[model samples]
Target: MALTDAPVAAKSAKRLRRQPLWIIYGFVFPAMAMALVFDYYPALSGLYLSMTNTMEVGIQSQFVGFSNYVQLFTSSIFLNSLWHMLVLAVVGMTIGTVVPLLVAEMIFHLMNGRWRYVYRLTFLIKMLVPGMVVVEVWGYILSVGGLLDKICHFLGLPGGSTGWLVDQHTALPAIMFIGFPWVAGVGILIYYAGLVAIDPEILDAAAVDGSGGLHRVLNVDVPLVLGQVKLIVILSAIGGFQGYFAQFLLTQGGPGWSTMVPGYYMYQSAFVNGDMGLASAVGVFLFVLIFSITLMNMKYLRSSQDYAGQR
Candidate 1:
């Protein structure tokens, strides 16, 4: 009887230990359900919609089976828009990732904690400003006789006579320069936090070994905070890939499609041309491209870390 009772008691304790896990899973289930309903369901719907022709007036959406995608790839305007998006994404990714990391390094090296806090707070405040407001402000800055143009005029430069946003040569470049310096609040803050979390003893040891500032940053700092770098790169890629709001507001995909991007073209297809199927196809393409690159990036990072034995 005592032997049987001992086994029963052990089983009871094991079951008790699992109760909290069950409760945790119960707590998480609802949020997962909501995400599936609101986020993933729409994505799946869009995927389905991409394969069908949803353009018929007062009729059921007919199954088109990849025809929309064929139309998209064949269209010069669509391909051009994709090229523009690719350029913007590449340029934005580089600038956005590098500038914030460099700024964060600067802030981290500040001996005065108060100044670091002040700078961080300032960037955070900038983040709170509405996106539309930022765009409008930049529009004014790029407009003729506005701040940039006036500065250019003071320097006696051409192309300042017209709004930079209206010039075929400068329009895309103007869109690219919207957030000058690109010290995005989230990027700076996240990188700064990652840097701050690094063990100061390691940095001190590096310094003791006669490592200069750049050397320390390259060998010690960057490796330690590479996870943060990866995070920022992925985020910047996503943002730049879908970035068309500035074009929508400032350029309207003009001066003559110079600023056209896939996102803007998708808007044109859906709203301007009433071609929901093509728009859905574009959405699917962007999603796939982003997802594939993100996966590849993560895989590369993981393999590199493994090879270098990063902690």
Candidate 2:
């Protein structure tokens, strides 16, 4: 009887331990349900809609079965837009990632904490302003006889008559340069946090060994913060690929299609042309591209072990 009772008590204790886990699942279920309803449902619906010829609402649409994709692949405009997006993603990621890192390093090395906070708040305040407002303001600044033209005139340069946003040559560059002197608030904060997490004793040791300035940064500081750098790189790539608001608000794909990107192409297909099926196909392409690259990044570019191995 004692042996049987001991086994029963052990089983009871194990069941009791699982009760908290069940409660946690109960607490999390509603939020999970909401995400499925709002986010995942729309994505799945888009993929389904991509298979049909959904020209407009309240109209009978037929199943096309990959015709839209075939048309898109053969379209020169779509290929050009894709090339523009690739260029924007690479250039934007490089400048956005590097500039903020340098700024964060400058701020972190400041002797006065108060000044550091002040500079941080200054950059952060720009992010608080509406993105549309920023784009509109830049539109004005890049237009004919705007800020750049005025500066060019002051410096005795020609081409003041030409608009930056209107010229095929300058339109893309103008869009990419909107956030000039890049020092993005979020990027700076992330890099600063990475710098802060480094062991101070290691820095002190480097200093004692005569490591200074660029040497310390390149060798010790950068290696220690490679995890954050990798995270920023991956996120920047994703954002740059999906981002089209600046192009939409500023160029509207431009005097020509010089500033066109994949995101804006999708937007124009759906809203301007009212071709929902093609738009859905574009969305699917974007989803697959972003998802595939993200998975590859996670699998191959893991910063923790990669940087540790660098040592």
RMSD of each: 7.7, 7.9
Tens-digit lDDT track for model 1 on 1-311?
Answer: 11112345555666554467878889999999999999999899899889988874566888999999999999988899888898898898888788988999998999799999999898889888999999999999999888998887778876467789988888888888898978866889878878887788988899899985788888988888787787778888999898789987899899988888999999988888888899999999999999997898778767756855644
> What lDDT score goes with residue 297 in model 1?
78
Question: Best candidate per TM-score, number?
Answer: 2
In model 2, the runs with Cα more than 4 Å from the true position are 1-29, 301-303, 306-311
* TM-score of candidate 2 to 2 decimals: 0.88
Which stretch of 10 consecutive residues in model 1 shows the poorest summed lDDT? 1-10
Write one digit per residue (lDDT tens) for candidate 2, span 240-266.
888999877878887689998889989
Which residue pairs show backbone clashes in model 2? Answer: none
